[model samples]
Target: MTTITTSAPAIGPLSTSTIAPANPRAPSRKSGIAAASLIRLSGLFAVAAGLVYAGIQPIHPADVLASVTTQSWAVIISLKLAMCLAFLVGIAGIYARQAGRAGWLGLAGFVVFGLSWFLQSGFVFTELFILPPLASIAPQFVDGFLGIVNGHPTELTTGPMAAAYSVVGLLYLVGGILMGVSTVRAGVLPRAPSVLLALAALVTPAAAMLPHALQRFAAVPVGVAFVWLGIALLLELGRSRA
Candidate 1:
C-alpha cells in the first residue's frame, strides 16, 4: 500500500505548424478571381466585335468605286477598323481558353485566322485613310481596286495590291472555315454558334452572288455566331464562378 506518486509525463510544446491553421494557400483565391475576371472581359469584346462586324455588312455599300467616296463609306471603314482590332484581341482569348482541347488543327486555324485579321487591318486602314483620298485623283486605280473586291475584271492593273486583295479574301475564307471547324471539333463552345460560323464562311460566296440588297444578309450568320459565343462564354463563366 505504498504511496505511488507517478509524476505526470512531461508535455512538450505542441509542434509549431509551418502550415497555416486554416489554409496555407488561401491567397491564391484572389489570383484565380482576377484571371476569371480578365477572361470574362474578353468575352465582352468578342460580343462587340461580332456585332459590329456582322451588323455593318447589310449596310455596306456595293463594291462599286462610287461607294468609296460617300460619307457612309467612311463611317463603314471606321467601324471595320474597330471591329478588326477587337477581333484580334477577342479571338486570341477564345483560342487560348480552348487551346489545350483544340489541338494542332485548332492551333493552325488560330494562327492563320489571326494572321488574316492582322493583314485585314492594313486593308481597312488603307480604305479609311489612303483609298478615299485617291478616290478622286486616281479614279482608275480606285475602280480597279473596286473591281478586285467584287471579283470583277478591271480596266487598270492593281499591281501588288490586287494580289494582296485576293490573298486577304482567300485567307479570310480559309481561316474562318478552319477556325469554325476547329471550334466545332473542340467542343468548348455551343455547337449552334460553331456551326453557324462554318456556315457563314460557306455562304459568303453565295452571298456575294446575291443581289446587292441581299449581299449584306450574308453577314447575319457571322454576327449571330459572335453574339451567341459571347453569351455562351459569359454563361460558362457564371456557372464556373457559381
Candidate 2:
C-alpha cells in the first residue's frame, strides 16, 4: 500500500534567524566602541552648540557684567558647566574601550581639554559675574574689574589672570591636537570627522590669538564643521542600529 506521507519542509541549518535572541547584545567589541565614540561625538556637538551661541553675539564687558549680576548669567554659565561635564563623561566612556596604555594618553588629553575650558570660561565668568558686584561695592575695584571685563586691562591682562587664560588657550590647542590624533589612530571613529575635528583644533588657536576681524570668519567654518560631524555621527549610529 502506497501511503501518502506528509512531511514538513526541511529548515536549512536551523536558521540562526529563529535562534537569535530578540534583543541581541552587540556582537563585537568594535560595535560597543563605535557606540561609545558616537556618544562622545554627540557630547562634543553639545559643547560646540554652547560655544556657537557665545560666539554669535558680542558680549561686551558691560553687557557681560550686567548679565553676570542678573540670574540670566547664572543660567548661561550653568549650561556651560553642564556641557563640559557631559564632554568629560563622554571622554570617560571612550577611554574605557581602549585596549592598553594608549587609553591613558587619551584620558590625559581629554582632561587637559576639560581643564582648559574650565579655566577660560571661569576667567570670563569671574570677570563678568564676580568683578561687577565687587566693583559696585568699591569704586577702586572698578578699574581692575573693567580691565578684566574689557579683556584688555594693562594690569590684569598682563597679570596672573591673563596668564591663566593664556595657559588655558595653549592647553586647549595642544590637548585638542593630541586627542584628535589619538582618536584618528584609534580607528574607532570615521576618518572624515576626525580630520575635521583636528582642523577645528588648529583653528581655535588662530582665532584666539588673531585680531577679531581676521578671526571672525573662522567661526563660520568651525561651527559648520562641528554641526556636520554631529549629523554624521548620528547617521552612523542609526545605521549600526539598523
lDDT of 2 by residue, 97-165 (tens): 342444766677667766766676666556545655765565444455445534555553367765665
TM-score of every candidate: 0.81, 0.59
TM-score, candidate number 1: 0.81
Tens-digit per-residue lDDT, 1-242, candidate 1: 88978565544554343333877476798877887777677788889889997788767877677888899999888999998888877777677767888898888877877788889899788778877889889978777776766666475846787888767767777777887898899999888888888788777777777766677777778778877887787788878999
**Candidate 1 weakest lDDT stretch, 10 residues:** 11-20
Off by over 4 Å in 2: 1-81, 90-105, 124-128, 138-151, 156-158, 213-235
**Clash tally for model 1:** 0
